[model samples]
Structures are given as structure tokens and as C-alpha cells.
Target: MDNQKRTMNTDAVISIRDLRISFGEYHVLRGVDLDLYQGENLVVLGRSGTGKSVLIKILVGLLKADAGTISAFGQRVDTMSKKELDDLRLKIGFSFQNSALYDSMTVRENLEFPLVRNARNLSRGDIDRAVEEALENVGLSQTINQMPSELSGGQRKRIGIARTLILKPDVMLYDEPTAGLDPITCIDINNLINEVKERYNTSSIVITHDLTCAKAVGDRVAMLFDGQFQRVGTFDEVFDTDDERVQQFYHYNFVE
Candidate 1:
């Protein structure tokens, strides 16, 4: 896909400034600032325990920030009420690290669960259509009746994405989408991420340690170190920097 042509209307869908979060004196995020623009993928690269997951949790309002301002779609997330936050979450899709599909549910059932809960007003026919469309988006329409256990890692990841897509979210938050998958499967997942961006025209934040995944899916890349962004730029711009720390983190030699 031609990302240059796809890039239109540079508007910020999500913005964070001076964001600070701490857990019992241990600071996870310290004065972090980020902006996720519409129709673009912003990949955050960081080692484990650098608060990537915590950042997403705060964005979704799962965890409160100690200090900072977070605004999504022009509304202040930090100041929103529980009801408002819950309503806002519907517009955001979160793909967890493990795919997080319920083992007891079939693929169809899993896809339907979100619609049944969030889209209560939809008719049965609408719900079925939504499920089918979501599955077809991920190219998994045939696995409708299959259980989560019967699917491969890649398949489960696709189902997880389908479940998220069922809501037709305006923003997507992906936490380690390529984790625990084989290299080939990782590439497939990365391709799907790109496809989703083009198809939905949604803004996305992809948190990952995998550089290949970052390069494949991210329109812009941000590196998190010491509770702040060490650098932010296009993949090549950041990767080609002269900073030793950045080079060391990316395993400089391996990236080429």
C-alpha cells in the first residue's frame, strides 16, 4: 500500500503531555509526551518494564496517572467520568499481548461477545453480519465455528483482531501483537496490522520490542528509555541515528 497516498488530514486523535505514572514510588512513566495522528501508525519501541503496557492502560483509563494531561478525540481522558471513559473505550480497539481469546468460546461466539455487550441495540441479524464482516476482514471466515484451542497462534491473533474490529474502532492500541509467534507468523501479523490501518483509516499505537514489526507496521517510531522518549522519527530516521544507546537497543548490526 502507498502510505504516502494514504496519509491525509494530519490531525491528532490522541495526545498526551507531561504524562507521569508511578506505582508505589517506582516511576513507570515520567513526563512522557505522545501524539497519535489520524490515519497513521505510531510504534513505541522499548525494552520490557519501560511502562509500554502501563501507558496503554492509562490511555484506556484502566490506571490513573499521577500527573499529566491525556486527551483523546478532543476530550480530556484524565478528567472523564467512569461512564464517559467507558463510552470512549468503544471507539478504541485494544489487542492484548496474548490475543486473550476465551478458550471456552468458539471463534464466532468470541466475535459476537463484544457486539452483544457494547451494541445491545443491534438486532440479531445485524450482530451476525458484523461478526461475519469482522472475520472476513482478517481472512478467517471459515474458522467461525472453531474453538480458540483449535486455532494456531497466528489464527488466534487474527481472531483477537476480528473481535476488536467488530466495534469498528477509530483508534487501535496494539500491545505486542507479534509476541510469542514464529518469525513467519510475526510477518503475517505485521501485514495484518498494516492492512487494518489502510482498511479502517484508523490511528494506531503499536507497542513492541520487535524492530521488524515496528518497521513493517509503524508510520513513525518512538523509542522509550528512562521513562521518556529517547527519540521519535520515521523508522529510517530513528534507526539511522548516531546515538549509541539507540543503536545498542536496536541491536544496530541486526537491523540492517
Candidate 2:
């Protein structure tokens, strides 16, 4: 439960302080503070609409924060220009909840998209090698030519991860990685997440409501509620908390 025991490195890869966001009049994240260290998986545990997705979007520079500072790898994210943010994104991999693979593209093409867009200087051989390595990392090299439509939900998710891996990101963001999969497939994806982290030595933020995924992938868990992180610690530490709001999340009593 102790953060010192949970984290492998004291170096913070991502630092967010008093982060706040809103949509017109409805506030989403009020004032959230979080620090993700190198080589650690920090799980954000929150009910639906608690701004878990928004926080990561801000981290990746996809969304603008109305207040507070976001620092990634010691660079100020809030002030980064579009070009600078694009370069930053190359080091941060995001696996979306819906898999977000190109339905029309084959597995290989989906994996090649990032390289083609960002790694423009890579030779044909280099791109091919990158794709092969990423697929092998996800245990899907044999499915290289298969279309997204041909794969199962879990396989599609793996492909999404492979696509992210092709870029060799330093930080990984998984948004509901196991959502919509069967229990068995969920477990498979969970294991794959662990494998990727160990293989790449990447720091990550896994946003999910599934406690099983949290316990399996998280070095520390933070419960997001009422536009802020109410509590943060190891899975058991947060699970055992007496805070009523955290207990509501623990018991699946989400506010509607």
C-alpha cells in the first residue's frame, strides 16, 4: 500500500496538478493531482463520467485543460505547440476502449499507419521490421494479413496494442482495455498488458472500472470521484479505505 513500495522509480514521467476541465457549464474534472512514475502502472479507478478519459486526453494533449499544469517527461504539456505535442504523442501510446482499429485495413496496415505517419524517414524494410516486431510482441504475427473484421474482440484489442507498440512509446495509456470482452478474453488482455509493460519497461495509466484488471495491472490505484482523485494507494489499500465515496466505487454504487 505504501507508494514507495509500489513504485519502482522515484522519477515522475507525468505530473498533473490541480487539473480542471469543463464542458460549457458542466464541470468534469474539478482539481485532480496525479503523478505517474517511470516503469509503474497507475490505475485510475472511477465510475462512468468521473473524467477518467478526460484526464488521459489532457495528458496526451488531445484536450485542453481549463486550469492547472500537466508536465510530461518534464515538458509543460499545457503550453506545448501543436507540433511539439505531436512529437510528444509519438512517445505516448494510447489503446482506446473500442480497439479503434481501421476496420477496412488489414492487421499489418493498421500497425503500419503510425509508422507511415510519424516515422516518415523509415525505409520500407525498417517499417516492415517494426510491424513484425510489434506483432510478435503481442503474439499476433501470424494474423498480419487478416482484416480487423476477421478477428475476435480480444484479437482486435491486441492489434490495437500492437499498433501502439510499433511506435515504441515510453508511456502507455490503456482506456478500458478489457471492456466488452468475455471473461476469458479479458484475462488474456490483462496478461498481455503486463507482458507489454515488462517487455517495454513503459510507465502506464490504466483507466478502468474492473477491479480485477486494476489488481492485475496496477502498481497503485487512484479513485476518481466528484471531479478529483479522492484516494490513491495500492489496490488493497484503496479497497480497504473507509471513505464513503471510495466505498461506493468499491461496491459499484455509482451515482447516476
Candidate 3:
């Protein structure tokens, strides 16, 4: 097969078609179709009021779509049984924009909680090993015993990532991973994301308003506007397409 056909033939880990979501009278997403390829980092960008966060929630089954097909990891999610959703979640992980760490638990325990809850067959030693490996992956082995309150924002975010990593999820969704971090820390996190992708072959869907972060980590970029995807393409293709809305957003946010 030619490169274009080969690209098209590769099955997507996450696929949505004609997805429509509404909150009573307000439409949040409209006929949105998206496909995320294996190990591809696709970034969804949009203005604040757009449904970026809602998109994240839907992909992870936190929110149900009003209409459409939602499939992830070869399973149709739109009508999955509760038991199936639980099984599917074992193969997918979501890191919220807010770290959402449990303040009462130590970082190690926070990471351990999911593993213990989901992988009931795992012994205590196996769970500890997994937690240690996750912490090591995030470069936070030293902070395993520390509380979320004792860590900085960036550290807490890493801990959240560690928690997600402990699940060994096949697809990872990151909502605004770079938000509220200093420039250096943002770069650090971006590099860490790249490292994780390279090491684990983790497919990712990242939603963010951070153009710099998007450009740094995205394999392809999709813009959500007016309850639909305005454009979807490689970073260069979409950013340089000369589309008025994209140009406006780029210039308004990125012009120095």
C-alpha cells in the first residue's frame, strides 16, 4: 500500500462519528468525527468556552454523548454494558486538568488505589512493584511517601501521571497537561510526555489552549469551534492552512 493508503488503513484506537452532545438546551458538541491512531498524540485546541474539556470527559466515559458512535480500543462505547465499561477502563487512563489527587493519601497510596481496586488479582507486592515502577517512570520515586499537599503543582501533576501509568493504559487522555506551569516546568512536562510515549507507545489525546504545548507534543492538531472540529491535520498543515479562524486564533494568542 502507498503511504497515504497505509496511513488510512491503520486502525484507530479511538474513533467517534457524528457525535452530538447537549446539556439541556445548549449543544456542546455537534457531529464531531475524530480518530486517534495507535501511539499518535493528537491535540485538540479551542477557545475556553468551547467543549475541549467535555470532549475529554466523553472519550473516557465520564460523560455520555447524546448521539453518535464512540469506540475505543476496538469496543463500541456508546452502548457498552457497565461491566464492559469497567473492563475497557482498565485499558484506558485519564488525567484531569486538575491533578485531582486524593489529599488524604500519600502519593504512593494514591497511585496504588487504582491498581488495587482494578487489579484485584494482584498481590500486595505486585501492586507495590507497579506503583514503584510508575513513580520511577515519572521520575518521582523520591516522592512516593510524600503527601499531595507537600508537592508543588508540577510534582502533583507528575504524581497524577504516575497514577495513570500504574494502570498501564493503552490510551491516555491528558486535559490541559501544561496549564498553570512555569515555562521551564511546562517544557519539562512536555518532554516527560514525549518520553512516556516513546517508552510505552501510549496513544494520547491531549486537549489544551496552550499552543506552545500543542506544537511541542502533537503529531496532529484538531481545532474545536462552534461545536465541531474546524480542521484536523498535522501541526504544519493545520496551523499554516490560512483558515481565517485558525489564523485569528494563532495570531491573537501567539503574536508576540
Candidate 4:
């Protein structure tokens, strides 16, 4: 494979080069390179424990890479200070795999938390409007007064997305958006991922092992294997090859 396609380019909303991390003797990511272009959904495909989730954490400075270059919005994430990282993170929205909603807070309060804490000097009206708009975007406006426990699995996921959307981040990072959901719910989340890009014009990196989610949401796909991206292309392009590793992924396309 020619290296230029995966190498960092100026137009990429997020670019990573030679990203490597390890746990004592076990190297999780040997040397990973990826580029997320503007307004494009780049799916990072890998089996569980391949470090897909770790890569996402590294992007947001939740975890540090042993060695690599991570650039988001033209800023070097690996070199950023705490203040700088915090500033950069405000522009990136991360939707966790399990939809990490606060059980103690109502849907409205959960949505308001980020804005109230991050955005200053906002009157009660501003927060209320933002919360309402976000809930509406995810088609969960009616659940505003409800608790996280009261919502279904899919509804909670939508609310998670809504909370992220409320911040109006320029980039979205979704970690297994379709994990642990029914087929119909997965389709809805897939549709929502596409809808988000169109509606917000935000570039995204969706990390998942689910091939169905990849084909539906990814403008391009990159497969992480053996601690590196061994395949990078479209849904068909990546899996069309006869490589046993890639074929194995295609054969087990459904979410577990």
C-alpha cells in the first residue's frame, strides 16, 4: 500500500502519525497512522482489545501515547499543556460506547451541565434554549424531564449524543456507536451519525468492530490489526481483499 493516503495531510480535521502505545510488555498500537478529512466520517475498525478505544482517549488527552504525533484542528495534541488540551477538547465531542449519562441528573440537567460549566455568563434562558435545541436534534425533547434510568437503551444513546451536540463541537468522536443495541436501533444510530455530519458539518472518527456501522457511516474505513492499520479504504475496498484478517472481520459483521 502506498503510504501517502494514510499520512497526515493539511486538509484533515484530525491527523495521526506513527501513534504507538504499550502496556508494560504488550504493545497495543505499534505505529498507527490515520487522517480524518473535513466533513468526513472515518471509521476505525478493529476487534475488541485492538486499542480502538485507547486511540480515542489519546485524541482527547485522556491517555497519552507512548510515541506519536496527534494533530487536531492543526494543533499538536501530544504537546499541548493542560490548559491547551482543555481548550482543544471543547471543540471535540466524544460519544462514549456505553452512553455515559449521569443517572442522578435529569435529561435536561445532564444536557445543561457542559454548557453551564464551560460557557460562562449565560442566563437561565440561554441554558434552557440550548438544552431544548439539543434534545430536539436527537428527537428526545419529550424525555427532557426524565431520568437516564427511565429511557430505553437507544433513547439513552440519543440523549448522550444530544448532550454532546449541545456543545456544538466541530469534531465528533464516537466509540462504538452501535454496540449493544438491536438491529433496528443500530440502523437508527447509523442514520443519526450520517445525519449529524450533514446537519452539523462536523468531521468524525467512529471506532467500532461492527461492519454494518462502518459501511453505513464511514466515508472511508481503516482496519486496525496487529497493532496497526493493515487495511484502509472504502467498506468494499477494505473487505473486498482476500486477506484472512480482513475477511474474518467481514464474515462476522454483526454486533455482538
Off by over 4 Å in 2: 1-10, 253-256
Model 3 segments more than 4 A misplaced? 1-10
lDDT by residue for model 4 (1-256), tens: 3677546677888889999999889999999888888999999999899999999999999999999899988889999999999999889999999899998999999999999999989999999999999998888899999999999999988999999999899999999999999999999999999999999999999999888889899999999999999989988888789898787777777532
Query: Rank by lDDT, descending?
Result: 4, 1, 2, 3
Q: Which is the leading candidate under TM-score?
A: 4
lDDT digits (tens) for residues 1-256 of candidate 1: 2434233223679988878998997898998888888899999999999999999989999889999888899888999998999899999999988899999999999999988999889999999999999999999999999999999989999999999999999999999999889999999999999999999988999999899999899999999998988789999999787887888877853656
Global lDDT of each candidate: 0.90, 0.89, 0.87, 0.91
- Candidate 1 structure lDDT: 0.90
Say which candidate scores most in lDDT.
4
Per-candidate TM equals 0.93, 0.92, 0.94, 0.95
Which pairs clash inside model 1?
none
lDDT of 2 at 241: 69
Clashes of 3: 0
True-structure lDDT of candidate 2: 0.89
Q: Estimate the Cα RMSD of every predicted model relative to the unseen true structure.
A: 5.4, 4.2, 3.5, 2.0
**Better model by lDDT: candidate 3 vs candidate 4:** 4
* Cα TM-score of candidate 3: 0.94
Model 3 C-alpha lDDT per residue in residues 141-167, reported as the tens digit of each score: 999899999999899889998898888
